[model samples]
Target chain A: MKDDLTDRILVVLSSVLMLTAVYMIFFYAPTERVMGIVQKIFYFHLPLAFMAFLSYFVAFVSGVLYLVKKDIKWDIIGSASVEIGVVFTTLVLITGSLWARPIWNTWWTWDPRLTSSLILWLIYVAYIILRMSVEQAERRATFCAVMAIVGFIDVPIVFLSARLWRTIHPVVIKSKSIDMEPAMISVLAISMAAFLLFWITLIRIRSRVDFMELRIRNLEKIKRGGME
Target chain B: MKNLTYLAAAYGIVWAGLFSYLWYILSKQNVLVGRIKALEGDD
Candidate 1:
């Protein structure tokens, strides 16, 4: 019951954040002169990309914790994070395509950032699919943990490759020399906050669902006398 | 000439994507609710 209440709260909070983000992006955020209305996609797209990267980082850290402590909780966290990361990465790709269609005059381009994002999405999808392929839970989790750690390391390399390639994508804010307008920065900030909340809510919901599933499966095993 | 085309495409994708997510969540929740009900029936 307590867990149910927590889930309800998370659902409510997530809905609020998502709606607020929509409102802010549509009404409050100033339009970009260059991109016009299509610029609004940035509020969602870039944040989704950032959150996806963050999820992978969490997966890597959880993987390390699992390896060190041999705790199933750490494994669960790692797995859950990877699942959420894949979802967000997929969103990033779709939203990026939408944005790129307008601004870049192409639905899909070999731009450095765009290409790296696509690669990252595929790698994470493969990670999840790899987990599903294994029959044994412990072995699956162990292999996935190692993969999570390696995939997270690849993110920086992806960024570096994007820079080295000098494709059409804009440089990430921190690395760029030019300053953004105050309005644009504020919109990005609010969008980031909303996205952060949404990510946490999704992670919590996913983790709880995974926990219940594992529990129910174990119960069935016990009933069947599988365990000694 | 080009801007209107961009606007239509952007809004179309956004609405379509949101509807897709809504459908997904609704279906997933329905499945989970059914499972809980089945477990309750077993008890």
Candidate 2:
């Protein structure tokens, strides 16, 4: 009962904040002098990237914990995190492409940041596929835990690719400070907060499903031939 | 208003993808609920 209330609160809060973020993105933030309307993509693009990285980080931690503790719950966390992480990364890639068409004069580019991010997406996708192929529960969980940890190696590379290489991707955050005005900064902060809540809500939903799946599998084992 | 098509497309796809994923999760939940009910009925 308590958990359901918390989930409802999170769902409502996330929806409200997301609507606010949308309003602020389209109305509150000032248009860039050069990029014009297309610069609005930055509002969501940045947050999507942040969430992707955060999701994978959670998956990585879950992997480590699962390996250390051999807990199915930790494996479930890693699996759920990776699934959402892929969704966010897909949005990141597509939105980045959309923004690049007008800004960079191309739909896609082989730049360092773009390439590394694509690699990161592909790795997680393979993780999901590989997990599906393994039949045994413990073996599947162990395989996923290992892949989640190893695949996370691409995350840091994606993060630093823009800074390390000469790329068209704009580095919004420098070591000292941000490059935008106060209005834009506020919008970004709101969007980030909204996305954080969005991530939490989705993660909870996915975790519940994961738990349900485990229950169903146990019930199936009983249905096969075992005593009730 | 420049590049408005691109802007709209970007936001549109993001929302569509998110809502679709949410719908998928809920549908999966429904399927599991049915399966659980059926299994419990058998026992």
Could you give candidate 2's per-residue lDDT for residues A38-156 as a string of tens digits? 99999999999999999999999999999999999999989999999999999999999999999999999999999999999999999999999999988999899999999999999
Docking class of 2: high
DockQ of each: 0.30, 0.81
lDDT of 1 by residue, A42-80 (tens): 777777778888899999999999888888888888887
Q: How many backbone clashes does every candidate have? A: 0, 0
TM of chain B, each = 0.89, 0.90
Q: Each model's TM-score?
A: 0.84, 0.95
Looking at model 2 chain A, report the run of 10 residues with the lowest lDDT sum: A1-10
The TM-score that candidate 1 achieves is 0.84
Runs off by more than 4 Å, candidate 2: A1-5, A226-228
